[model samples]
Target: MYSGLMSTPERLIESTRELLWERGYVGTSPKAIQQHAGAGQGSMYHHFTGKPDLALAAIRRTAEQMRATAEAVLGGTGPAYARIEAYVLRERDVLKGCPVGRLTMDPDVIADDELRAPVTETLDWLRERLAAIVEEGCAQGEFTPGLDPQQVASTVVATVQGGYVLARSAGSPAAFDTAVRGLLALLAAARTPASAPAAS
Candidate 1:
Protein backbone atom coordinates (compact mmCIF):
# COMPACT_ATOMS: atom_id res chain seq x y z
CA MET A 1 0.00 0.00 0.00
CA TYR A 2 1.09 3.59 -0.83
CA SER A 3 0.06 7.10 -0.07
CA GLY A 4 -3.12 8.45 -1.68
CA LEU A 5 -1.20 11.57 -2.62
CA MET A 6 0.91 9.53 -5.05
CA SER A 7 -0.17 9.59 -8.71
CA THR A 8 -1.39 6.44 -10.41
CA PRO A 9 1.89 5.96 -12.29
CA GLU A 10 3.88 6.47 -9.07
CA ARG A 11 1.72 3.96 -7.25
CA LEU A 12 2.15 1.51 -10.10
CA ILE A 13 5.94 1.82 -10.02
CA GLU A 14 6.15 1.54 -6.22
CA SER A 15 3.87 -1.47 -6.24
CA THR A 16 5.95 -3.13 -8.90
CA ARG A 17 9.11 -2.54 -6.88
CA GLU A 18 7.64 -4.22 -3.80
CA LEU A 19 6.31 -7.12 -5.85
CA LEU A 20 9.60 -7.54 -7.66
CA TRP A 21 11.39 -7.71 -4.31
CA GLU A 22 8.81 -10.07 -2.82
CA ARG A 23 8.49 -12.27 -5.92
CA GLY A 24 10.76 -12.76 -8.87
CA TYR A 25 9.79 -11.45 -12.29
CA VAL A 26 7.96 -14.63 -13.27
CA GLY A 27 6.02 -14.74 -10.03
CA THR A 28 4.94 -11.09 -10.19
CA SER A 29 1.84 -11.00 -12.34
CA PRO A 30 0.29 -7.91 -13.93
CA LYS A 31 -2.94 -8.50 -12.08
CA ALA A 32 -1.06 -8.57 -8.79
CA ILE A 33 0.63 -5.30 -9.61
CA GLN A 34 -2.65 -3.66 -10.47
CA GLN A 35 -4.31 -5.00 -7.38
CA HIS A 36 -1.51 -3.86 -5.10
CA ALA A 37 -1.26 -0.48 -6.78
CA GLY A 38 -5.02 -0.03 -6.72
CA ALA A 39 -4.84 0.85 -10.40
CA GLY A 40 -7.09 -0.56 -13.07
CA GLN A 41 -5.75 -2.68 -15.93
CA GLY A 42 -6.44 0.26 -18.24
CA SER A 43 -4.46 2.57 -15.99
CA MET A 44 -1.50 0.20 -15.97
CA TYR A 45 -1.48 -0.10 -19.77
CA HIS A 46 -1.88 3.65 -20.26
CA HIS A 47 1.24 4.48 -18.18
CA PHE A 48 3.59 1.74 -19.45
CA THR A 49 3.91 -0.48 -22.48
CA GLY A 50 3.74 -3.69 -20.46
CA LYS A 51 5.14 -5.56 -17.51
CA PRO A 52 8.73 -5.47 -18.80
CA ASP A 53 8.53 -1.76 -19.40
CA LEU A 54 7.08 -1.07 -15.97
CA ALA A 55 9.46 -3.48 -14.31
CA LEU A 56 12.42 -1.75 -15.89
CA ALA A 57 11.23 1.53 -14.48
CA ALA A 58 10.78 -0.02 -11.05
CA ILE A 59 14.22 -1.62 -11.16
CA ARG A 60 15.86 1.63 -12.18
CA ARG A 61 14.15 3.43 -9.34
CA THR A 62 15.32 0.81 -6.88
CA ALA A 63 18.88 1.06 -8.17
CA GLU A 64 18.86 4.82 -7.85
CA GLN A 65 17.53 4.58 -4.31
CA MET A 66 20.26 2.11 -3.37
CA ARG A 67 22.99 4.37 -4.78
CA ALA A 68 21.58 7.35 -2.93
CA THR A 69 21.52 5.45 0.35
CA ALA A 70 25.13 4.27 -0.01
CA GLU A 71 26.33 7.69 -1.04
CA ALA A 72 24.78 9.25 2.03
CA VAL A 73 27.23 7.40 4.27
CA LEU A 74 30.17 6.73 1.93
CA GLY A 75 30.28 10.34 0.83
CA GLY A 76 30.05 11.73 4.35
CA THR A 77 32.89 13.42 6.22
CA GLY A 78 35.13 11.04 8.18
CA PRO A 79 38.15 8.82 7.85
CA ALA A 80 37.70 6.30 5.04
CA TYR A 81 37.49 3.33 7.41
CA ALA A 82 34.78 4.96 9.48
CA ARG A 83 32.77 5.78 6.39
CA ILE A 84 33.02 2.23 5.11
CA GLU A 85 32.12 1.00 8.58
CA ALA A 86 29.07 3.23 8.62
CA TYR A 87 27.91 1.79 5.32
CA VAL A 88 28.08 -1.83 6.46
CA LEU A 89 26.56 -1.08 9.84
CA ARG A 90 23.64 0.85 8.39
CA GLU A 91 20.21 -0.44 9.32
CA ARG A 92 18.43 -2.81 6.95
CA ASP A 93 15.78 -5.50 6.73
CA VAL A 94 18.20 -8.39 7.22
CA LEU A 95 15.59 -11.14 6.97
CA LYS A 96 13.85 -9.67 3.93
CA GLY A 97 17.19 -9.47 2.05
CA CYS A 98 18.43 -6.66 -0.19
CA PRO A 99 16.01 -5.17 -2.66
CA VAL A 100 18.51 -4.70 -5.47
CA GLY A 101 20.65 -7.69 -4.57
CA ARG A 102 17.61 -9.95 -4.78
CA LEU A 103 17.23 -9.18 -8.47
CA THR A 104 20.59 -10.76 -9.21
CA MET A 105 19.01 -14.13 -8.31
CA ASP A 106 15.94 -13.61 -10.47
CA PRO A 107 16.29 -15.70 -13.63
CA ASP A 108 13.91 -13.53 -15.63
CA VAL A 109 15.69 -10.32 -14.69
CA ILE A 110 19.11 -11.82 -15.37
CA ALA A 111 18.20 -13.17 -18.83
CA ASP A 112 17.07 -9.81 -20.22
CA ASP A 113 19.92 -7.39 -20.87
CA GLU A 114 17.59 -4.43 -20.60
CA LEU A 115 16.20 -5.61 -17.28
CA ARG A 116 19.60 -6.59 -15.94
CA ALA A 117 21.51 -3.41 -16.83
CA PRO A 118 20.45 -1.43 -13.76
CA VAL A 119 21.19 -4.32 -11.41
CA THR A 120 24.66 -4.91 -12.85
CA GLU A 121 25.41 -1.24 -13.17
CA THR A 122 24.34 -0.49 -9.63
CA LEU A 123 26.54 -3.27 -8.25
CA ASP A 124 29.49 -2.21 -10.40
CA TRP A 125 29.06 1.35 -9.25
CA LEU A 126 28.99 0.24 -5.62
CA ARG A 127 32.20 -1.72 -6.01
CA GLU A 128 33.92 1.17 -7.75
CA ARG A 129 32.75 3.66 -5.16
CA LEU A 130 33.91 1.47 -2.30
CA ALA A 131 37.23 0.92 -4.04
CA ALA A 132 37.76 4.64 -4.19
CA ILE A 133 37.09 4.83 -0.48
CA VAL A 134 39.49 1.99 0.23
CA GLU A 135 42.12 3.66 -1.90
CA GLU A 136 41.64 6.81 0.11
CA GLY A 137 42.00 4.85 3.32
CA CYS A 138 45.28 3.45 2.13
CA ALA A 139 46.53 6.92 1.31
CA GLN A 140 45.53 8.14 4.78
CA GLY A 141 47.13 5.14 6.43
CA GLU A 142 43.76 4.01 7.73
CA PHE A 143 44.47 0.69 6.09
CA THR A 144 47.88 -0.97 5.67
CA PRO A 145 49.88 -0.46 2.50
CA GLY A 146 49.62 -3.03 -0.35
CA LEU A 147 45.93 -3.73 0.25
CA ASP A 148 44.26 -3.83 -3.15
CA PRO A 149 41.51 -1.25 -3.25
CA GLN A 150 39.43 -2.99 -5.91
CA GLN A 151 39.73 -6.37 -4.25
CA VAL A 152 38.84 -5.00 -0.83
CA ALA A 153 35.87 -3.23 -2.36
CA SER A 154 34.62 -6.42 -3.93
CA THR A 155 35.05 -8.22 -0.62
CA VAL A 156 32.95 -5.63 1.19
CA VAL A 157 30.17 -5.94 -1.35
CA ALA A 158 30.34 -9.70 -1.28
CA THR A 159 30.19 -9.77 2.51
CA VAL A 160 27.07 -7.65 2.68
CA GLN A 161 25.31 -9.55 -0.11
CA GLY A 162 26.41 -12.87 1.29
CA GLY A 163 25.44 -11.83 4.79
CA TYR A 164 21.90 -11.19 3.59
CA VAL A 165 21.67 -14.70 2.16
CA LEU A 166 22.99 -16.18 5.38
CA ALA A 167 20.57 -14.24 7.53
CA ARG A 168 17.60 -15.19 5.39
CA SER A 169 18.61 -18.85 5.37
CA ALA A 170 18.74 -19.08 9.16
CA GLY A 171 15.70 -16.82 9.62
CA SER A 172 17.72 -14.72 12.05
CA PRO A 173 19.46 -11.36 11.93
CA ALA A 174 22.27 -12.73 14.11
CA ALA A 175 23.92 -14.37 11.13
CA PHE A 176 24.07 -11.08 9.30
CA ASP A 177 25.39 -9.32 12.40
CA THR A 178 28.10 -11.91 12.84
CA ALA A 179 29.23 -11.53 9.22
CA VAL A 180 29.44 -7.75 9.54
CA ARG A 181 31.33 -7.88 12.85
CA GLY A 182 33.77 -10.37 11.38
CA LEU A 183 34.47 -8.07 8.44
CA LEU A 184 34.95 -5.09 10.75
CA ALA A 185 37.39 -7.09 12.80
CA LEU A 186 39.40 -8.00 9.72
CA LEU A 187 39.42 -4.39 8.58
CA ALA A 188 40.53 -3.24 12.02
CA ALA A 189 43.39 -5.66 11.89
CA ALA A 190 44.39 -4.17 8.56
CA ARG A 191 44.69 -0.67 10.02
CA THR A 192 48.15 0.84 9.77
CA PRO A 193 49.92 1.22 13.12
CA ALA A 194 51.02 4.73 14.07
CA SER A 195 54.60 3.49 14.48
CA ALA A 196 54.60 1.74 11.10
CA PRO A 197 56.64 3.24 8.30
CA ALA A 198 54.84 4.68 5.31
CA ALA A 199 55.21 2.82 2.00
CA SER A 200 58.34 4.14 0.33
Candidate 2:
Protein backbone atom coordinates (compact mmCIF):
# COMPACT_ATOMS: atom_id res chain seq x y z
CA MET A 1 0.00 0.00 0.00
CA TYR A 2 3.04 2.32 0.30
CA SER A 3 3.04 3.99 -3.10
CA GLY A 4 5.74 6.64 -2.74
CA LEU A 5 8.38 3.88 -2.82
CA MET A 6 11.63 5.24 -1.45
CA SER A 7 13.92 2.29 -0.76
CA THR A 8 13.49 0.91 2.76
CA PRO A 9 17.21 1.14 3.64
CA GLU A 10 17.46 4.75 2.51
CA ARG A 11 14.38 5.67 4.52
CA LEU A 12 15.72 3.97 7.63
CA ILE A 13 19.10 5.69 7.39
CA GLU A 14 17.48 9.09 6.81
CA SER A 15 15.17 8.57 9.79
CA THR A 16 18.08 7.58 12.01
CA ARG A 17 19.91 10.74 11.01
CA GLU A 18 16.95 12.91 12.02
CA LEU A 19 16.42 11.15 15.32
CA LEU A 20 20.10 11.45 16.12
CA TRP A 21 19.92 15.15 15.38
CA GLU A 22 16.88 15.60 17.61
CA ARG A 23 17.48 13.22 20.54
CA GLY A 24 21.10 12.14 20.21
CA TYR A 25 22.56 8.64 20.53
CA VAL A 26 21.09 7.45 23.81
CA GLY A 27 17.73 9.05 23.21
CA THR A 28 17.21 7.44 19.81
CA SER A 29 15.62 4.01 19.41
CA PRO A 30 14.92 1.56 16.63
CA LYS A 31 11.17 1.97 17.12
CA ALA A 32 11.49 5.73 16.80
CA ILE A 33 13.51 5.31 13.62
CA GLN A 34 11.05 2.79 12.22
CA GLN A 35 8.09 4.98 13.04
CA HIS A 36 9.77 8.01 11.55
CA ALA A 37 10.77 6.14 8.42
CA GLY A 38 7.46 4.32 8.08
CA ALA A 39 9.33 1.08 7.87
CA GLY A 40 8.65 -2.21 9.62
CA GLN A 41 10.84 -3.83 12.28
CA GLY A 42 11.76 -6.58 9.88
CA SER A 43 12.91 -4.03 7.30
CA MET A 44 14.99 -2.16 9.84
CA TYR A 45 16.57 -5.33 11.17
CA HIS A 46 17.37 -6.41 7.62
CA HIS A 47 19.16 -3.09 7.07
CA PHE A 48 20.77 -2.59 10.47
CA THR A 49 21.37 -4.90 13.38
CA GLY A 50 20.57 -2.28 15.98
CA LYS A 51 20.77 1.36 17.04
CA PRO A 52 24.56 1.45 17.08
CA ASP A 53 24.70 0.28 13.49
CA LEU A 54 22.23 2.89 12.41
CA ALA A 55 24.06 5.52 14.43
CA LEU A 56 27.36 4.72 12.77
CA ALA A 57 25.79 5.36 9.40
CA ALA A 58 24.24 8.56 10.61
CA ILE A 59 27.52 9.74 12.15
CA ARG A 60 29.37 9.18 8.89
CA ARG A 61 26.70 11.08 7.02
CA THR A 62 26.98 13.95 9.48
CA ALA A 63 30.76 13.99 9.16
CA GLU A 64 30.56 14.16 5.39
CA GLN A 65 28.11 17.04 5.56
CA MET A 66 30.39 18.96 7.96
CA ARG A 67 33.34 18.52 5.62
CA ALA A 68 31.36 19.70 2.64
CA THR A 69 30.17 22.73 4.57
CA ALA A 70 33.73 23.66 5.60
CA GLU A 71 34.90 23.43 2.02
CA ALA A 72 32.10 25.70 0.88
CA VAL A 73 32.79 28.27 3.58
CA LEU A 74 36.59 28.26 3.60
CA GLY A 75 37.50 27.78 -0.06
CA GLY A 76 38.17 30.42 -2.75
CA THR A 77 37.21 33.92 -3.90
CA GLY A 78 37.74 36.33 -1.02
CA PRO A 79 40.22 38.00 1.30
CA ALA A 80 41.13 35.53 4.07
CA TYR A 81 39.67 37.76 6.82
CA ALA A 82 36.50 38.16 4.80
CA ARG A 83 36.31 34.42 4.22
CA ILE A 84 36.82 33.61 7.92
CA GLU A 85 34.23 36.18 8.88
CA ALA A 86 31.85 34.82 6.31
CA TYR A 87 32.33 31.32 7.69
CA VAL A 88 31.68 32.42 11.25
CA LEU A 89 28.74 34.68 10.44
CA ARG A 90 26.74 32.11 8.52
CA GLU A 91 23.32 31.83 10.12
CA ARG A 92 22.77 29.04 12.62
CA ASP A 93 20.29 28.09 15.30
CA VAL A 94 22.50 28.86 18.29
CA LEU A 95 20.43 27.00 20.86
CA LYS A 96 21.00 23.73 19.11
CA GLY A 97 24.67 22.96 19.51
CA CYS A 98 26.24 21.90 16.27
CA PRO A 99 24.81 18.51 15.35
CA VAL A 100 28.29 17.01 15.36
CA GLY A 101 29.41 18.81 18.52
CA ARG A 102 26.40 17.53 20.42
CA LEU A 103 27.68 14.00 20.03
CA THR A 104 30.58 14.77 22.34
CA MET A 105 28.11 15.29 25.18
CA ASP A 106 26.40 11.94 24.65
CA PRO A 107 27.87 9.31 26.97
CA ASP A 108 26.97 6.43 24.71
CA VAL A 109 28.83 8.06 21.85
CA ILE A 110 32.00 8.71 23.87
CA ALA A 111 32.03 5.10 25.05
CA ASP A 112 31.97 3.77 21.52
CA ASP A 113 35.14 4.18 19.48
CA GLU A 114 33.41 3.62 16.18
CA LEU A 115 30.92 6.34 17.00
CA ARG A 116 33.53 8.75 18.35
CA ALA A 117 35.77 8.56 15.27
CA PRO A 118 33.49 10.47 12.96
CA VAL A 119 32.89 13.17 15.54
CA THR A 120 36.59 13.61 16.12
CA GLU A 121 37.36 13.63 12.41
CA THR A 122 34.73 16.22 11.65
CA LEU A 123 36.01 18.64 14.31
CA ASP A 124 39.60 18.07 13.26
CA TRP A 125 38.76 18.92 9.68
CA LEU A 126 37.04 22.13 10.75
CA ARG A 127 39.99 23.24 12.92
CA GLU A 128 42.53 22.51 10.22
CA ARG A 129 40.48 24.27 7.57
CA LEU A 130 40.17 27.38 9.70
CA ALA A 131 43.86 27.26 10.58
CA ALA A 132 44.81 27.15 6.93
CA ILE A 133 42.77 30.26 6.30
CA VAL A 134 44.39 32.06 9.22
CA GLU A 135 47.82 31.06 7.98
CA GLU A 136 46.90 32.47 4.62
CA GLY A 137 45.86 35.73 6.26
CA CYS A 138 49.17 35.97 8.08
CA ALA A 139 51.10 35.38 4.86
CA GLN A 140 49.06 38.03 3.06
CA GLY A 141 49.81 40.65 5.76
CA GLU A 142 46.15 40.65 6.66
CA PHE A 143 46.56 39.19 10.16
CA THR A 144 48.94 39.59 13.11
CA PRO A 145 52.49 38.61 12.19
CA GLY A 146 52.93 36.05 14.97
CA LEU A 147 49.34 34.85 15.25
CA ASP A 148 49.20 31.20 16.08
CA PRO A 149 46.89 29.77 13.48
CA GLN A 150 46.29 26.54 15.35
CA GLN A 151 45.47 28.33 18.58
CA VAL A 152 43.18 30.80 16.85
CA ALA A 153 41.45 28.03 14.97
CA SER A 154 40.96 26.09 18.17
CA THR A 155 39.53 29.15 19.87
CA VAL A 156 37.17 29.75 16.99
CA VAL A 157 35.88 26.20 17.16
CA ALA A 158 35.68 26.33 20.94
CA THR A 159 33.84 29.66 20.91
CA VAL A 160 31.20 28.29 18.58
CA GLN A 161 30.82 25.15 20.66
CA GLY A 162 30.78 27.08 23.90
CA GLY A 163 28.27 29.52 22.46
CA TYR A 164 25.93 26.66 21.81
CA VAL A 165 26.42 25.32 25.33
CA LEU A 166 25.83 28.73 26.84
CA ALA A 167 22.74 29.33 24.74
CA ARG A 168 21.29 25.94 25.55
CA SER A 169 22.13 26.43 29.23
CA ALA A 170 20.78 29.95 29.48
CA GLY A 171 17.77 29.29 27.26
CA SER A 172 18.56 32.34 25.17
CA PRO A 173 20.58 33.36 22.11
CA ALA A 174 22.20 36.36 23.79
CA ALA A 175 25.24 34.40 24.89
CA PHE A 176 25.70 33.17 21.36
CA ASP A 177 25.68 36.72 20.04
CA THR A 178 28.07 37.90 22.73
CA ALA A 179 30.49 35.12 21.93
CA VAL A 180 30.30 35.76 18.18
CA ARG A 181 30.81 39.46 18.60
CA GLY A 182 33.80 38.90 20.82
CA LEU A 183 35.30 36.60 18.20
CA LEU A 184 34.69 39.12 15.43
CA ALA A 185 36.44 41.75 17.50
CA LEU A 186 39.42 39.44 18.01
CA LEU A 187 39.60 38.82 14.28
CA ALA A 188 39.36 42.53 13.64
CA ALA A 189 42.24 43.16 16.01
CA ALA A 190 44.25 40.61 14.06
CA ARG A 191 43.78 42.71 10.92
CA THR A 192 45.02 45.98 12.46
CA PRO A 193 48.31 47.52 11.27
CA ALA A 194 50.29 46.15 14.25
CA SER A 195 49.13 42.67 13.22
CA ALA A 196 50.50 43.35 9.73
CA PRO A 197 53.82 45.03 10.37
CA ALA A 198 55.51 46.79 7.40
CA ALA A 199 58.44 44.93 5.85
CA SER A 200 61.89 45.76 7.35
Candidate 3:
Protein backbone atom coordinates (compact mmCIF):
# COMPACT_ATOMS: atom_id res chain seq x y z
CA MET A 1 0.00 0.00 0.00
CA TYR A 2 2.82 2.38 0.85
CA SER A 3 4.36 2.01 -2.58
CA GLY A 4 1.00 2.79 -4.15
CA LEU A 5 1.13 6.60 -4.07
CA MET A 6 4.05 7.77 -1.95
CA SER A 7 6.44 10.02 -3.82
CA THR A 8 10.14 9.35 -3.71
CA PRO A 9 10.95 12.25 -1.37
CA GLU A 10 8.04 11.57 0.99
CA ARG A 11 9.04 7.96 1.33
CA LEU A 12 12.60 9.01 2.07
CA ILE A 13 11.66 11.42 4.84
CA GLU A 14 9.16 9.05 6.46
CA SER A 15 11.65 6.23 6.47
CA THR A 16 14.30 8.51 7.89
CA ARG A 17 12.05 9.46 10.81
CA GLU A 18 11.45 5.87 11.89
CA LEU A 19 15.09 4.91 11.42
CA LEU A 20 16.30 7.90 13.38
CA TRP A 21 14.00 7.02 16.25
CA GLU A 22 15.19 3.43 16.33
CA ARG A 23 18.81 4.29 15.58
CA GLY A 24 20.60 7.52 16.29
CA TYR A 25 22.39 9.56 13.68
CA VAL A 26 25.52 7.44 13.94
CA GLY A 27 23.66 4.21 13.45
CA THR A 28 21.71 5.43 10.43
CA SER A 29 23.51 5.27 7.08
CA PRO A 30 22.60 6.10 3.50
CA LYS A 31 22.36 2.45 2.56
CA ALA A 32 20.21 1.73 5.59
CA ILE A 33 17.90 4.59 4.75
CA GLN A 34 17.67 3.44 1.16
CA GLN A 35 16.84 -0.09 2.21
CA HIS A 36 14.27 1.07 4.70
CA ALA A 37 12.71 3.55 2.32
CA GLY A 38 12.67 1.04 -0.53
CA ALA A 39 14.29 3.72 -2.62
CA GLY A 40 17.38 3.45 -4.75
CA GLN A 41 20.69 5.16 -3.97
CA GLY A 42 20.18 7.45 -6.90
CA SER A 43 16.60 8.17 -5.88
CA MET A 44 17.76 9.27 -2.44
CA TYR A 45 20.70 11.31 -3.68
CA HIS A 46 18.54 12.78 -6.43
CA HIS A 47 16.18 14.39 -3.90
CA PHE A 48 18.79 15.47 -1.34
CA THR A 49 22.49 16.10 -1.02
CA GLY A 50 23.06 13.21 1.35
CA LYS A 51 22.10 11.63 4.63
CA PRO A 52 22.56 14.81 6.65
CA ASP A 53 20.31 16.83 4.38
CA LEU A 54 17.57 14.23 4.45
CA ALA A 55 17.98 13.80 8.20
CA LEU A 56 17.71 17.52 8.82
CA ALA A 57 14.45 17.53 6.93
CA ALA A 58 13.23 14.59 8.98
CA ILE A 59 14.21 16.20 12.29
CA ARG A 60 12.53 19.48 11.45
CA ARG A 61 9.31 17.72 10.50
CA THR A 62 9.44 15.74 13.75
CA ALA A 63 9.94 18.90 15.81
CA GLU A 64 6.94 20.58 14.25
CA GLN A 65 4.82 17.49 14.86
CA MET A 66 5.83 17.34 18.53
CA ARG A 67 4.86 20.96 19.10
CA ALA A 68 1.57 20.57 17.32
CA THR A 69 0.70 17.50 19.39
CA ALA A 70 1.60 19.26 22.63
CA GLU A 71 -0.36 22.32 21.68
CA ALA A 72 -3.46 20.24 20.98
CA VAL A 73 -3.58 19.34 24.66
CA LEU A 74 -1.96 22.45 26.21
CA GLY A 75 -4.06 24.95 24.32
CA GLY A 76 -7.33 23.06 24.60
CA THR A 77 -10.26 24.34 26.59
CA GLY A 78 -9.72 23.42 30.21
CA PRO A 79 -8.58 24.76 33.55
CA ALA A 80 -4.82 25.26 33.58
CA TYR A 81 -4.14 22.35 35.92
CA ALA A 82 -6.39 20.15 33.86
CA ARG A 83 -4.52 21.09 30.72
CA ILE A 84 -1.17 20.43 32.34
CA GLU A 85 -2.42 17.13 33.67
CA ALA A 86 -3.74 16.16 30.29
CA TYR A 87 -0.47 17.11 28.66
CA VAL A 88 1.55 14.83 30.94
CA LEU A 89 -0.95 12.05 31.34
CA ARG A 90 -1.52 11.68 27.62
CA GLU A 91 -0.77 8.12 26.52
CA ARG A 92 2.83 7.65 25.41
CA ASP A 93 5.09 4.88 24.17
CA VAL A 94 6.85 4.28 27.45
CA LEU A 95 9.25 1.75 26.02
CA LYS A 96 10.12 3.75 22.95
CA GLY A 97 10.41 7.06 24.85
CA CYS A 98 10.07 10.46 23.25
CA PRO A 99 11.29 10.71 19.66
CA VAL A 100 12.79 14.14 20.22
CA GLY A 101 13.96 13.50 23.79
CA ARG A 102 15.83 10.40 22.66
CA LEU A 103 17.97 12.49 20.35
CA THR A 104 19.64 14.21 23.28
CA MET A 105 21.56 11.02 24.03
CA ASP A 106 22.83 10.61 20.46
CA PRO A 107 26.51 11.55 20.30
CA ASP A 108 26.51 12.13 16.56
CA VAL A 109 23.44 14.28 16.84
CA ILE A 110 24.89 16.35 19.65
CA ALA A 111 28.17 16.71 17.80
CA ASP A 112 26.44 18.20 14.75
CA ASP A 113 24.85 21.63 14.95
CA GLU A 114 22.46 20.98 12.05
CA LEU A 115 21.14 17.87 13.77
CA ARG A 116 20.97 19.29 17.28
CA ALA A 117 19.33 22.66 16.69
CA PRO A 118 15.84 21.32 16.12
CA VAL A 119 16.11 19.10 19.19
CA THR A 120 17.18 22.01 21.37
CA GLU A 121 14.63 24.38 19.89
CA THR A 122 11.79 21.88 20.20
CA LEU A 123 12.56 21.20 23.88
CA ASP A 124 13.03 24.88 24.60
CA TRP A 125 9.66 25.57 23.02
CA LEU A 126 8.10 22.87 25.17
CA ARG A 127 9.53 24.46 28.32
CA GLU A 128 8.35 27.94 27.38
CA ARG A 129 4.86 26.68 26.55
CA LEU A 130 4.65 24.73 29.81
CA ALA A 131 5.84 27.76 31.75
CA ALA A 132 3.18 29.91 30.16
CA ILE A 133 0.51 27.40 31.20
CA VAL A 134 1.82 27.39 34.77
CA GLU A 135 1.77 31.17 34.80
CA GLU A 136 -1.83 31.09 33.63
CA GLY A 137 -2.71 28.66 36.41
CA CYS A 138 -1.12 31.02 38.92
CA ALA A 139 -2.99 34.02 37.57
CA GLN A 140 -6.25 32.12 37.92
CA GLY A 141 -5.44 31.34 41.58
CA GLU A 142 -5.06 27.65 40.84
CA PHE A 143 -1.48 27.61 42.08
CA THR A 144 0.31 29.09 45.08
CA PRO A 145 1.17 32.75 44.62
CA GLY A 146 4.85 32.10 45.20
CA LEU A 147 5.19 29.30 42.67
CA ASP A 148 7.80 29.85 39.94
CA PRO A 149 6.47 29.08 36.49
CA GLN A 150 9.74 28.46 34.70
CA GLN A 151 11.13 26.33 37.51
CA VAL A 152 7.97 24.27 37.74
CA ALA A 153 7.92 23.95 33.98
CA SER A 154 11.48 22.68 33.98
CA THR A 155 10.60 20.19 36.71
CA VAL A 156 7.71 18.84 34.66
CA VAL A 157 9.92 18.36 31.61
CA ALA A 158 12.66 16.74 33.69
CA THR A 159 10.18 14.36 35.25
CA VAL A 160 9.05 13.07 31.84
CA GLN A 161 12.58 12.76 30.46
CA GLY A 162 13.78 11.10 33.65
CA GLY A 163 10.75 8.84 33.58
CA TYR A 164 11.86 7.55 30.20
CA VAL A 165 15.29 6.65 31.58
CA LEU A 166 13.87 4.83 34.57
CA ALA A 167 11.36 2.91 32.49
CA ARG A 168 14.04 1.74 30.08
CA SER A 169 16.30 0.71 32.97
CA ALA A 170 13.58 -1.20 34.76
CA GLY A 171 12.18 -2.75 31.58
CA SER A 172 8.65 -1.64 32.38
CA PRO A 173 6.29 1.32 32.24
CA ALA A 174 5.79 1.33 36.02
CA ALA A 175 8.61 3.76 36.55
CA PHE A 176 7.11 6.20 34.09
CA ASP A 177 3.68 6.02 35.71
CA THR A 178 5.11 6.39 39.19
CA ALA A 179 7.10 9.43 38.20
CA VAL A 180 4.09 11.07 36.57
CA ARG A 181 1.84 10.34 39.54
CA GLY A 182 4.45 11.72 41.90
CA LEU A 183 4.75 14.90 39.88
CA LEU A 184 0.99 15.33 39.74
CA ALA A 185 0.75 14.87 43.47
CA LEU A 186 3.30 17.60 43.94
CA LEU A 187 1.40 19.89 41.60
CA ALA A 188 -1.83 19.23 43.45
CA ALA A 189 -0.15 20.04 46.76
CA ALA A 190 1.09 23.28 45.30
CA ARG A 191 -2.47 24.42 44.57
CA THR A 192 -3.88 27.10 46.84
CA PRO A 193 -6.87 25.76 48.74
CA ALA A 194 -10.19 27.15 47.57
CA SER A 195 -11.79 29.70 49.88
CA ALA A 196 -14.37 28.33 52.31
CA PRO A 197 -17.92 28.41 50.99
CA ALA A 198 -19.80 31.64 51.79
CA ALA A 199 -21.36 31.45 55.25
CA SER A 200 -25.08 31.93 55.85
Best by TM-score: 1
User: Candidate 1 has what TM-score?
Assistant: 0.96
Model 1: pairs clashing at backbone N, Cα or C within 3 Å = none
RMSD of each: 3.5, 3.8, 2.8
User: Which candidate order results from sorting by TM-score in descending order?
Assistant: 1, 3, 2
Local accuracy of candidate 1 as per-residue lDDT tens digits, 27-103:
89999999999999999999999999999999999999999999999998788888888999999999999999999
Looking at model 3, which ten-residue stretch has the lowest summed lDDT? 191-200
Q: Point out where model 1 deviates above 4 Å.
A: 195-200
> Which should have the higher TM-score, number 1 or number 2?
1
Model 2 residue-pair collision total? 0
Models sorted by lDDT, best on top: 1, 3, 2
**Between prediction 1 and prediction 3, which has the larger TM-score?**
1
TM-score per candidate, chains pooled: 0.96, 0.90, 0.95
In order, candidate lDDTs are 0.94, 0.85, 0.90
Candidate with the greatest lDDT versus the true structure: 1
